[model samples]
Target: HSLHCQHPNTNFCILTRPNTHTHTHSMVDCHILLYIFPGQGAINPALQFAKHLIRMGVKVTIVTTVFAHRRITAPIPEVLTIVAFSDGYDEGFKLGDHDAQHFASELRSHGSRAIAELITASINEEGQGHPITHLVYTMGQTWAAEVARGLHIPSTPLWIQPATVFHIYYYYFNGYGDMIRKHTTTDPSCPIEIPGLPLLLTSRDLPSLLVPSNSNSYSFALPAFKEQLEYLLDTETNPPKVLVNTFDAIEPVALRAIEKFNLIPIGPLVPPPSLDRKDYAEWLNSKPESSVVYVSFGSFVVLSKQQMEEIARGLLESRLPFMWVIRETEEIGDKLEELEQGGIVVPWCSQVDVLSHPSLGCFVSHCGWNSSLESLVSGVPMVGFPQFTDQTTNAKLIEDVWKTGVRVTPNEEGIVNGDEIKRCIEMVMGGEEFTRNAKKWKALASKAVKEGGSLDMNLKAFVDEL
Candidate 1:
């Protein structure tokens, strides 16, 4: 006799059938084994996608770092198994540390060995004895893909940004490296166009890795990103499978630009908002539809004190009901009180929940990919105030490609004044055009994830080949 437990949230079910008892109708019908390798910020979406794989009768296991294990705030699915590996930073990696480059080297060496051992252990008679057939890895951790190749296991790279950014990086390392370097070195403000992308990207619109500002602390990781692309090219016979976090209708050109790799768009991978209510629910319920502006810069990207103050003044001057998320360390002193009078301030809340709320009309964002996708799916307009990395790229996509939002331009002093923030907010919130565009993208994004959609068919084809 066997017992089955179903998770109310995710459709996947947990089965306690004996190994010898194989039934055609069981939840564990398929014998396909999937090993997933995802990095820090990318892990959350990876896990969500992995659960869907489980629902499709694929046995999935996640291999990540100890720091990432602790950082995951979402509830894990009952059928999935997660194993943590050491990245040489068991305590956690800190910014501005001298060991930045050394840390990258350590992660590559130690992580490769750890992943190799994990694969071996799973197959060995003394261990769980499951044979892993396919491996899927995310960006920057190319070493995991190398491990899979060494084991003769089929694997793919999961690109976690908009396809346009992938095309930008591909062009930079391939033939346009020197040209891009020249433009950024002499003048970052100059607009330079890439081969496939229609937009004329300024240095501000490029990834910080190619043209890092003095404040960009992670320039050491640029070589690692380059290495990832190099490894993708190393596989000769087959077009390397690149799983991108985008949809067909949104970035059709960028997704199909590279002929050498199969870029499968399988995302907007953010998990649906949980049913368990949080503290902010009541306050959000208090506001009317399309009235509140939700502001957040994400977990990373520490804003400067001066920048924070300027944003504070902007929100206050805008006079819109808002929700601002500030880190505990960031202090604005007396202004916090005045700002709270008109809106709410919290360290964190369920971002998806807030964005999906009827009260949310505008998002004042730093334009990270995860946040960008969330805003798109939620059908909320945005005021893009991009700070670093792919954020500038995402902001450009929002303002130009998608036209679902407006980007905030900083002054000559490199600070976005309160007046400028207010102007952008009014433009996004006051216009029906932005709202209509947002809803249109939201429908398209939702359609991609539904059954028999592009993402579903793509994922199924990839898994079936294994």
Candidate 2:
């Protein structure tokens, strides 16, 4: 027999449920299949969300690429099953080495077959496991919903980006593509006003995908998003329910912007403070509160040597104790050797833990949605050095809307220099305004996750449907 846990809480989803045999009624277990984006940024939040499901007595099975599954170092959370399907890249898919378009097509073809097999196998078991009753997919995972459709299970997309971005993309595909292109085609400084978004966005504030001059516009992800949104457009009676990783107080306007979508803000889905020992924790502990700079560009971004050197110069100039995560070692030079001596320089660390540390005053980041949310919830301000896709949009949110950070711009040479980095870091760290805003948002985020809070209420409502 499956686990029929009886632990109860004020929150409904946090309680465990009875199995078919335990309950005389016809109610079966609710099993959700979460198909996640393979990247570290996407995988972490999805896992956190799954943990909440398990607490609620729901069964969760995560399906991801074979390579991604192997790369995860953490012990898999108890009771949540992790399953892998090949993306035809059993080893790994390096963007620099592989073609993105071909990979997306292969993931769709192979993933669909594997999911069908997985679902079928579960059905055959007698009180062994539960068949998937609902499907939730992340970015670039629209094809999973197609499988859910064929299998007759309900599906919803978990949009990991800000709700504002989802709205921009919806507007683009539905009618505003040409007008947006016209506004962004020439100067990036041109103002492009999108309906429903309270603020007028410049091309700088837009996703690089919508900007014709930006390199990201040429990538396969744009088309993948287009396909995802287009499929949602055909529904008549029911508006597509999109689960976004943002909270109400932070994105009150954006959440209510689109009537076409039942945009559910069940997030700031940042994980709780980690208790695991970090090698740099002791050093961070020694520093004064809100005195150190934390720098990371997430897993994928590779900056030019000139830019890296400039950043190194700036951090050194700022004269703050710092922790920098430098993944791409080949492109960097000896300038970072100095960084390792006085500061902590590693390939990676527990980012959520680091950000939440009291010593962390400022975050120098790529403005990835995960990173941005983590920084905000941790009560840390930022110096945004964004690159590509949703990073630009998130940077705008950080600097303009949220008032919790500053952004750095590249000069004529297409590089953000040491001066710019130092300026932003010093500004963010020195200003009480940024820190105050960060603390304000952090408080709201905490309230949202408390029992019966906005995020908790939304997630509970969704779970109730199951």
Q: Per-residue CA lDDT of candidate 2, range 354-457, in tens?
A: 99888999999999999999998899999999998899999999998999999998998879989889999989988999999999999998998888888768
Give the number of the best model, judged by TM-score. Answer: 2
TM-score of each: 0.91, 0.92
Residue 459 lDDT, candidate 1, scale 0-100: 80
Worst 10 residues of 2 by lDDT: 6-15
Q: What is the alpha-carbon lDDT of model 2 when measured against the actual structure?
A: 0.81
Candidate 1: tens digits of C-alpha lDDT, residues 233-254: 8874777788888899899999
Clash-forming residue pairs, model 1: none
Indicate which candidate wins on lDDT. Answer: 2
